[model samples]
Target: MNADFPFRIVGFDLDGTLLDTSGDLAAAVNHALTSVGRPALSVEEVRPMIGGGARHMLAQGMAATGGCTEGELDVLQRRLLDYYAANIADKTQPFPGCLAALDNLTGRGVRLAVVTNKLEHLAREVLDALHLTSRFDAIIGGDTMGPGRGKPAPDPVLAMVQRCGGGSAAFVGDSVYDVQSAQAAGLPVVACSFGFLQQPVETLGAEAVIDHYDELIPTLVRLGSAA
Candidate 1:
């Protein structure tokens, strides 16, 4: 580890960074589509839409179904949320090497936390289902932290730092929103190459882009040293 690096806490985005929840999310989207008399989206078709919140996913599903009026979309969004909540952990799992990477960090005395745009209940359900609830020192979801505090804003990441006892921190995520949030929080960020990045990961201005969880420790060490 780089002795000069000031980081003590590492905040991760749940869905794309640590867990591969695309399968479950796609299933829920298709369920909503079927309920609304629309065609189901294939797994590949829904992968790119996974990082955003349920509203964004529902909006994309609506567009795919030829666009609904705002009121109609609201109904569909509610239904989609219900359906997704019912199936929250049907197929969710940690990405390859995620548990090992987290374990290494924990063993080395680094605090770990999750800051996600996902609904708090669902996020906790997925983590519990994957037996990962015990791994985090803190978990902040979009709904639990009150309004005016989601991704693309520094509130959630900053809150995570405060919850972890307030120290230097890093945020790991896969989207421009995460990059922006980390920047706003004045935290170094590591972007995941395999997450649902809508644009090139390099364009997000992350300190490093990691293709695998196994690279996390070494990258952190390198970044910490540089810092």
Candidate 2:
């Protein structure tokens, strides 16, 4: 939406965008539920509830179990977090072309960062597991730098840009939350159709919607050339 900025720094959403981590996340959620004598959620049921944050995911999981009281939800959330922490990398992995895309972007001199609602420690673990920890110039997690606002608020994305020297940046992600955050930050948004978007990716009002990471390099190149 912000054509004046064009593109320089590229920020990414972690969970569903770069990594297909539903398998492990769902497993952790179910593990927590089982520990508390609750039922487990199927992978499909847990996938859509992701991207918001761990509390949201835990709330959804508890809701699926016929609603827990406020205190109960808090207890469940803590247990789920502990379980998730222990199994963060069980079956989690980067989506196809994610690493290649990061490599290509870095090779082409694109400044990169990650802005996500995931917790910093868990996010770091995922990136480290994929050996991608060094690829990003910055990683702004949900709980990083205190409990600032989360996605759907521009704070995280804007913070990433500010930390990366505040040049032209593009936010790349899979959901409406990412689009909204980018817009709020006055950055152009790029939606990836291949990620876990709850609705059609086109509805996010991004500057462009790409289905593959390989398409990203040429798109940014075209934007740079145009600028």
Candidate 3:
């Protein structure tokens, strides 16, 4: 282990923070929208609707195109998930410098983990497709904790620490849900400015913000040093 590195473990949120999944996600949302005669939304229009789970994202899309009954939303959500699973990696790639940043952490002997609001199976599928599943010591998904216990609930974040065998840890993410979950788990969080932001990245209340993956190591080092 690198004694100079203060953090022994680091957890990441998958979608926007680790990978740019907007293309496939937007396609899935559009598929559901057009299936019921709703107008298709542009990728830019659908970007902010991500971070939340597929059902929540689809609901926002449904509302944007045209309001839907709960029943319709239920049906459309399944379709969205099914479509997304099949095309999860079509346009998804790690953000610039993401792989390098992860490698730096791993080289320092920092245990890496993924704590995402995405379902376990889907998260696994996407990571496996990208050949990234081997990098993380733990992969905790929204469903891994059970119904109603996803991010913003702190359950998954806590589970990440446990699964990683416990250590001084920190989180990196791109959403309010990520900040809340990490904070609630008593870890400092760094926000990604280039992520799928529903609001200003500064307003997410993370301890620090980085515009690119190249800044990740420095940011985490500063955060750890300050701690």
Candidate 4:
């Protein structure tokens, strides 16, 4: 690790933090809803429902569009995932300056990992489509750590450290689950103000907040120095 850089491994949340997947995600959700003759939601309306896994987002979508039974949710979730997998990168792209930020960290020899609540195959497929899968040292998904151990449980965050061969670590994300998971794993976390936030960014309780990826390296440096 570079002596000037305080962290050895940095973990990131994929969907909202690294990529702006709201457009494609919203489309997938609408696909499922429309298949059952339900109303479709706007990207804005579906943005906040992201961060959780697909099932959770679809559940929220169903609730918003007039509710559904458990079995209905089960069926819709499959439809949603199928549609999403096929259209994963249709409108998905890195957040502004995100690639630059990743390059900066990698230049400093900081191993990078992606820990997301999205399903593993789906996450990998999308990253593959964008040709970004090679950039990460580890790509852990909601299913990687098994059931009930995705986020807010410290498992995947801990797995990232282990997969990166262990060192001083930090995390970046846009949700309470991300903050809680990193904190539980005893790592400082930065929150993204431009991501799909379900609540006020300030309320997520991250160590630092960056409004744009342009601010990321400096914020991480500051946090590292403080540590």
Candidates arranged by TM-score, highest first? 4, 3, 1, 2
Question: How would you encode candidate 2's per-residue C-alpha lDDT over 1-227 as one tens digit per residue?
Answer: 23433466899999888898899889978876787788888999888888888888888888888777888778878888888887788898888888888876666666789988889888998888778888888998888856758888888898898888877788889888899988899887778888776788888898888888878867766655655
- What lDDT score goes with residue 82 in model 2? 85
User: Candidates' lDDT values, in order?
Assistant: 0.86, 0.83, 0.93, 0.95
Q: Where does candidate 3 stray beyond 4 Å? A: none
For model 4, what is the alpha-carbon lDDT of residue 34? Answer: 97
The CA-based lDDT of model 1 is what? Answer: 0.86
Badly placed stretches (over 4 Å) of model 1 are 1-6
- C-alpha root-mean-square deviation, each candidate: 1.7, 3.2, 0.7, 0.6
TM-score, every prediction: 0.95, 0.91, 0.99, 0.99
75-120, model 4: which lDDT tens digit per residue? 9999999999989999999999999999999999999999999999
Report the number of the highest-lDDT candidate.
4
Candidate 1's residue-wise lDDT over 1-227, tens digit each?
33444578999998889998989899988887888789998888887777668888878887977887888778877888888888888888888899899988887778999988898888898898878899898998887668767888888888899999987788899988888988899998999998877788899899999999999988988887788
lDDT of 3 by residue, 1-227 (tens): 79998898999999899999999999999989999999999999999998878888998999997699999998999999999999989999999999999999999999999999889999999999999999999998888989999998899989899999998999999999999999999999999999999999989999999999999988989999999
Mark the regions of model 2 whose C-alpha exceeds 4 Å error after superposition.
1-6, 222-227
